[model samples]
Target chain A: MKRLMAIFERDVTLAFRTGGGALNSVAFFALTVVIFALAIGPDRARLSESAAPILWTAATLAAMLSFDRILQADFEDGSLDALIESGDLLSLVALAKASAHWVSTLLPLILATPVLGLLLGLPAHAYFPLMASMVIGTPALSLFGALASALALSLRRASMLITILTAPLLTPAIIFGVAAANAGARGDALFGPALMLLAAMTLFGVLVTPAATAAAIRFNTD
Target chain B: MDERPADAGRLIAARDIAAQRGGRLVLSGVTLAIGPGDLFILRGPNGAGKTTLLRTLAGLSQRAAGALKRSDNASVFLGHADGVKAALTARESLSFWRMIYSAPPAIIERAISRLNIFPFLDQRGASLSAGQRRRLALCRIVISRRPVWLLDEPTSGMDAVSIRAVVDLIAEHCRDDGAAVVATHEPLDFGPGRTIMLDEAA
Candidate 1:
């Protein structure tokens, strides 16, 4: 628990203190929603139906903008070498990195969703489920993003490469996020698919990301 | 996590280790033992497999088949890259490393201060010069409290003061039952250190 907190604190510190990656995500999120609003001008009825998915897509893309922040920094700075040298659990290290990425990149997008939803003309009933789904779901994006980022760490302009790889992986989050919102807007229970998608992503992220990252680090370093 | 030996504070032992890169054998039948309080230098020209050998010793590569044993509680490796993020301040970088290193918080601060990086602690690592970045990499040893330091080109870029500081820090680490394997071509001054010519092995 203590070690996990140490990792968590470090991630949080990078997200809130450094402020570059986190702020960029927020700006991207805002831009995405604003552009979306302009593209589909003042048609509340049509926009309302697509609000949940659109908000989630924007969040995923915004999160994509900051995918390489943690691992790439560690890679360039030699901290990744230290981590590999220390004989610490690579899984835990990956988790710490993933946790930080979520806090910095995805958390802000989730926080801004209520406002973004408003821009989409989402009813109040849809807002709660939309926020809840994002809270549970976005960590997977961070985890998978970390994996892709680790895979491309040694390549040129790895951040963009990571973005390209991860955009497809996060499509499920958009699917479930929108489905849950539309279900909520219709006054229906979204607990089924919403919870299952979030749980599946979390489990997949936790189970697979670390080992992939370890292999990627070894390969890149080699 | 093996127990330390008595009388022979050998930090690293490699027996007939063979390593290959891209199906090409880089190092083969290499055997050496590095003892505590000893600074071992691996001297070779560029592309002479120096970094590959160092990376193998640091456990960063599976390309090598070797058994390496360390007497220290932990081992730390500093690769060719500086590894500091351009976006994070020096302090933030140190703090991030501190968390991952499993060192006590107070010791971490002392390590940071020891590098004389306290002044520019808040500055982004990219903003710092190449020499300062190297110093930050060196600080990991101080923070790690590990007995074995595997350093690849520890003094790539530095002024006289920073280089002296590195020498002093290595000397101090050796004095305190620590050992280091430094791979470099440049002449280094670590008092009473041994040089293992890697070129002679093949």
Candidate 2:
């Protein structure tokens, strides 16, 4: 438990440091949303209609910006080897890293969703659902992103590989997240089911990604 | 989860061990044993599988073929990379490892002083010199309190004084009944120990 906390604390501290990449993720998310709004013009109805998908997609892409570095730093510097030698389960270390990534990178995007939603002209009714979806959905992003990061560890052009590998896995979270927010915006009854599915995806990611990530890291290190 | 007692005689033993890197055999037909107070030196030319053998003994790489046995004593591996985080200070790195190993604070203090790390304790890993970074990484071995140490080129970037400090540290570790397998090009005096010639192993 102490070891896990140490990993988490160290990762979080690194994420906030210069060249840590967490701030870049948030900046990318905001810029992507703003660019979409500018490209879509001042058609409030059009912006409102597409708000949920735009935000969800931007969030997913932003999360990807930081994924490549999540385990790459540790792997390159021999920290991963030392970590494995620490006698703790690699799965636990993976969990700590992913959780830290979520907190440092994804959580900021979720927090900024409200402001981005305003820029998108999203309906007030959709606000809660959008934030709720982000809250529940981004963990899946971080979890699977960690897995992809580990899979691509030490490879040249690893960021591109992480994107290609993670996009397919993240489709479900984006789908369910956008669906939940759109349902709320349309005043339909689908929000509950959509949010539930998003939560389920995150829960499943929590249950499975750590071990999968550990296996990937083990393979790469070997 | 080997249930053997900590005081078991042998630390590590291997016979007919074969190790591979990049799917190619780098080392083969090796046999050795390590016990308490043993300091085994691995010497070889580059690409002669010195690093591969250290990594294999550390269990970081899979052995292509071998009969290996360990006595449940935890071993620490220090490789070519220093494993220092650029964002963290030297002190922070040691404290973090100390926490990970659940090592007592006294050991960390001892390591910091013995390795002459106090001068750069607050310097971030990115700013530390190669030798300083190596010293910080070596602290993990002391903080780990593990009986067996697998070190690769531990004195690569150190000056004469730092090298002596490290050699004395290893000698002290061996005197305390701990074992070490050091792979290095530079000669270090660890008193009495066997030397494994990887060129011959290959």
Candidate 3:
């Protein structure tokens, strides 16, 4: 447990350091939202109506932008080897890394969602549901994205491979996240079911991906 | 000096070991034993599989074929990469490793002082010279308190003084009943140890 916390703390510290991945991800998230608003033009109703999908898409892409470095940097620098030699279960290390990604990358994006919400003219009622969806849903992104990152470690064009490997797996979270937000926008009862399913997916990802990621990391390093 | 001992209290023993790199057999038909207070130096030309052999022993690479055994499973491996994070200061790196190993503060202080790392403790890994980075990486081995050390080119970029420090550290480690297998091109004076020539292993 102490070792796991050490891994988590170190990764989060690294993420917040100068030129770290956290800032880049948040910038990418905000920029992506702004670009979508501009491309779709200034029609308020249209912007509000498309807001949930746009935010979810931008968040997903921004999450991917940070995923590539999660394990690749450690692998490149030989920290992965050191961690493996530390005698802690690799799955616990993977879990710590994924948790750090969630905290350093996804949490900041969630915090910025409100501002981006205002920019997109997201319906006032939908804000809570959108944030809640991301809060519950994005762990899946970090977990599975970390799995992809570990699987893609040491490969050339690894980021591209991470995106390709992670996109399909994340589709369900986007579907459920966008659905919950839209339902909240309409003040409908469907919000409950959509959010529940989103939570379920995130919970499942939390349970499973770390071990698989550990296996991938071991294979790659070998 | 080259005779194998009968199996008794060996820290590590491998017979007819083979290791592959990139699906090609790079090292094969190797046999050796390491016991407490042992320091085995591996020497070979480039591509002679010295790194591969160290990595295989460290369990970082799969052994293609071998009967390998270890009396104790704990070992620390220092590879070519220093494993220092560019964004982290040297002190931060040491503290982070301290947490990973759950090492006592006194041990960390000893490592920092022994490696002469206090002068650059606040410098980020990106700014540290090669020798400094190597020193930081070596601290992990001390903090680890593992029974075996597998080091690949540990003194690669050190000046004479730093090299002497590392040699003393390794000697101290062996004197404390720890075994070390160091693979290096430069001849280091690790007193009273066996040498494994990888070219001869092949």
Candidate 4:
């Protein structure tokens, strides 16, 4: 737990203090919402119906943009190797890193969703579910994204490769996130697919990605 | 020479450890036990598996054919890269690592001061020279107080003064029952040291 906290805190500190990683995500989220609003014209009713999917899509893209830098910086600087040698539980370390990523990339986007919703003509009911779904779903994005980050650490074009490799895997998050938000907007039970698929993705990410990342770092460092 | 018995005071144990990269055999059937307080220096030419062997022993790389065990989990591995972030100051980098290793604040303060990096603490790592960045990376082990240190090309980019500082730090640690496995091509000339030539295994 201590080591995990250490990794988590380190990532959080880096995200906020050094890289300005969080701000970039927030800016992307805000800019994307603005451009989207401008492009769609003044048809408020159309925008309200489509608001949930649009907001979710923008948030997902913002999160994706920030994921590559999560592990790449650490790998480049030798912290990853040092952490591996620390004899701490690798999964805990991975979880902490993912948590930090979520806080930086996803948290800001989720926080900005209400304003975004208003811009897109979403009602209070629609906006609330969109925000709730984002809160539950973005951590899974962070988890799976970390694997892609680790895999692309040593590549010449890691940023671009991260998108190509992980975007396909992120299809499930998009599908379920859109469904849950839509259901919640329609006054239906949102717990079924929204909660289940997010939980499943979180489980798979926690169990599988860390070992692969640890192994990938081990292979690449040599 | 105070020869800590390799069998009795083993810091690292590898059995039948082999590694491959890009389908090429890097090392095969390699086995060794390094004792406590031993400055085990690795020597080999480029592409000779020196870095691979060090990383595998440090558990940073996959071993194709064997097992590796460490004593008490008291180890830190420093690779060829400086590992400092360009955006973060020297102090921030040290503090970040100190947190990761769970070292107390006092130890971290003492380490930065001891390494003469206190003056440069607020300077970004990107602004520092090659030697200064190396010093920043070394500070973690000093503050960590771990029982073992694993270094790959520790003094690769440093001048003579920085090299001496690294040697002094290693000697102090070994004197306190800590061990170090340093993989370097340069002559380190530290006392009570042993050499592991990869060509011998070849």
Which candidate should be chosen as best, given lDDT against the real structure? 3
Candidates 1 and 3 compared: the better one by DockQ is 3
Please compute DockQ, using alpha carbons, for every candidate against the native two-chain complex: 0.54, 0.81, 0.77, 0.56
Give per-residue CA lDDT, model 1, range A33-60, as digits (tens): 8888889888889888778777888888
Proportion of native contacts found in each model?
A: 0.66, 0.79, 0.79, 0.72
* Alpha-carbon deviation at A133 in model 2, angstroms: 0.4
Candidate 4: where is the Cα deviation over 4 Å? A189-222, B1-6, B28-31, B104-106, B200-202
- Alpha carbon lDDT of residue A109, candidate 1? 79
Residue-wise C-alpha lDDT for candidate 3, range A125-221, written one tens digit per residue: 8899899889999999999999999999879558878998999999999999999988877888999999999999988987899899999998899
DockQ for model 4? 0.56
C-alpha positional error of residue B80 in candidate 4 after TM-score superposition, expressed in Å: 0.7
Give the clashing pairs for model 3: none
Q: Pairs clashing in candidate 1?
A: A76-B83, A77-B82, A77-B83, A77-B84, A78-B83
Summarize candidate 3's per-residue lDDT along B1-202 as a digit string, tens digits. 1324574677778778899888888999888777889999999888889888888888788889977776655578999999999999998898989999888989889999999999999999989999889999999888898889999999878999999999999989999999999998887988888998878434
Q: Is candidate 1 or candidate 4 better by lDDT?
A: 4
Candidate 2 lDDT by residue in tens digits, A29-90: 99999999999999999998889899999999988878987899888889999998788889
Question: What share of the reference contacts is kept in model 4?
Answer: 0.72
Docking class of 4: medium
TM-score of chain A of 1: 0.92
Give fnat for candidate 3: 0.79
Off by over 4 Å in 3: B1-8, B71-73, B200-202
Overall lDDT per candidate, in order of appearance:
0.76, 0.89, 0.89, 0.78
How does model 1 fare in lDDT? 0.76
